[model samples]
Target: MSMFRHLLGVVITLLFVLLTCAVILPILMLALLKVGLPFARWQALCNRWLDWLASLWMDANARHQQLLLPTQLEIEGLDNLSKQEWYMMVANHQSWVDILLLLRIFNGRIPYLKFFLKQSLIWVPLLGLAWWALEFPFMRRHTKEQIARDPSLQGKDIEQTRKACEKFRYNPVTIINFLEGTRFTTAKYVQQKSIYRHLLMPKAGGLAFTLAAMNGQLHRLLDVTIHYPEGIPTYWDYACGRVKTIQVHIRQVPIPAELIGDYTEDAEFRAGFQLWVNQLWQRKDDLIESMKSTGAN
Candidate 1:
């Protein structure tokens, strides 16, 4: 049975990659055409088509997951969402399966979610190129030491954020930032001396910068909390239908006017922002504990 499940997982993984490559070919061509045509209306038309193709790809994957994985997904508070409204999705990071989960749940209910990717990811074969064409923001943060050596590197990420936000103004889009920065693991949990039992230290700067960058255009926040009752599962576990249940809770937070400020320059705003984030994470930690207690059945 275990061997059969493993083979099923392999087949699922291969089919997913094949689907991604198939979708990306037209994306590449449209991207080239958009580049060649400098007219704004023409570009906008191309953008719409790109979005349509991306939607088809996500829809395909959602069907694929539903057909193969028997994971019981229970969701809450996904109500009155519109593709015409802009949003910021802040979620905990746990596993690669989370991406698929998000894609499946939010596929048509909202506009496509744009992610902030590491700059190096643009070179990742097919999917990377699609991300580039679709205007996913790629960024790299410079360490203090690196900044000290190359003074010009300062504020590079901020500039990139501003540019990306400006483009997003033309279309209503949902931007996602995994505020924990990376996947959570026991080793990472201990390494950071994390105060939260189920999460890493929440990085408030990314959220703050995004709020600031949008200049109040993005006013609604989707506070997404994903819980796996049977421990966090890997992509393989999900693909093999080993994940029996999943829970997602979302809080539609209103972005207060006070939350938008220069996170890098304003000392008071930075302190306040961090406190807000800490309080939020604290609540999420408590919520996860409650979920564990109730979901263990």
Candidate 2:
């Protein structure tokens, strides 16, 4: 039964992707060009279309696969969110399905979510063009070793990318960063011997840079915690209908006033910010444990 279910899920997901690439995507791309909207507007329009299509696909897939979303999923403190406000969303990475879950949950309540991606992905055929069209921030990350070998490369790339983000000033945006940097695996967990349960160590550099660039313009921080009841559910599970329930806890937090400055420049503020992030990860660790315990029953 599981094998058959998996096969069916893959077929459906592929069909959806093919249809999206062949039909919906080209029309949207042409529409953006015809309207003469800026890249940010074009991206926003594309994301809205993707979000709607995903929801429709999920509903149809769920009904066919006999899957169910959480009936008692609780979103606390959502009332604190303002439609006019800009936010920075940070979440622990788990699976590719996490993106779809976020889109479904935060749909109309918050500004459309965007992520900083690698510049290389910009040429990735269909999805690449789509991401570029959507105005996703594509960055070139240089390692310390590379920078040390070539002393002149210090802050050039980051500064160039930061300048590109200036265009976002005209549009309300919610920037999301998966602080863990990569999805969790037992091998990686063993390699890092991570302090937090079910989480990798939070990478502070990206968050630091993001906060520095956005500064006072971002009104709040959305700390979201997600858990899958039956291990880490894959995209196949979602499509095949094997994933019946998912629990997500959203805590809308105020961006600490002191963190509004350039975190890279101030030592004291940087230490304080790192400590706060550690505390958030610790709490998320505990939350994951509690969810696992509840799901066991």
Candidate 3:
């Protein structure tokens, strides 16, 4: 039965992706063609199309999940959010299914979620182009070693990020940052010797850059923590209806006036910002423990 459900999910997922590309690809092309135009109206029109297409895709896949799985979700703290506000959202990463879970939970409740894709993902076929059309920010983060080799590369990525954020100035957007930077696993937890029992170390740089780029426009910072009562499930497990319960706890964080300074150049602000992020992580880790204890009962 599980195998049959998995196969059904795989087929439906593939068909949805293919159908999305077929419909959105042309809009993407047209958006590109009109990119250089002086007026912003055409670009806005294209963006609306992309947002509509993305919402449709999520709605369809959500229906598929309902038909193929008996998953249960418990979501809290969604009462105060609006789809019309610009937001910067941070979440703990766990598995590939996390993305799908986010889409399912936040569909229509907030502005369409847009991820900051790894720069290399720009090469991915179809979906990559779709992301580009939808104006998802693609970021290439440079390491200290890479920066030492080419001093000229310093702050280049930040500039690109700023330009990308400029595109969203006219639109309401919910930008999601996986602050852990990667998925959590037992191996990873032990390797990092992380203080948090359930979470990897939160990376502050990405969130910092996003806040710096969006600045005053992104007033609300959503600190989202997700947990599975049974255990973290793989994408296949989720597709096969093995994941029965999901808990999503959202905390709306107000961007402190002091924390919104220049993250790239300011030293004092950097220290303060990192401390704030760590504090948030500690709280989230504690929250997960509390949730687990309650679930055990």
Q: Any idea how many clashes model 1 has?
A: 0
Worst 10 residues of 1 by lDDT: 161-170
Query: Once superposed on the true structure, which residue ranges of model 2 sit more than 4 Å away at CA?
Result: 22-80
lDDT of 3 by residue, 1-297 (tens): 767877866875675677676666675766676686746787677678778878887887787777767888898898888999988889999998899888988888899899989989988877778787777889888889999999999998888888888887778999999998889999999999998889999988878877778777898888899999999998877876778899999999888767678777889989999999999999999999999999999
How close is each model in CA RMSD to the real structure?
1.1, 3.9, 1.8
Top candidate by lDDT = 1
Model 2 lDDT, residue 264, Cα: 65
Each candidate's lDDT (Cα)? Answer: 0.91, 0.73, 0.84
In Å, residue 170's CA in model 3 sits off its true spot by: 1.5
Q: Write the number of the candidate with greater TM-score, choosing between 1 and 3.
A: 1
Considering only N, C-alpha and C atoms within 3 Å, which residue pairs clash in candidate 3? Answer: none
Cα lDDT of model 1 by residue, 168-254, tens digit: 888889999999999999999999999998999999988888888889999799989999988999999999989999999999889
TM-score for all models, in order of appearance: 0.97, 0.82, 0.93
Q: Order the numbered candidates by TM-score, best leading.
A: 1, 3, 2
**Number of the predicted model whose TM-score against the real structure is largest:** 1
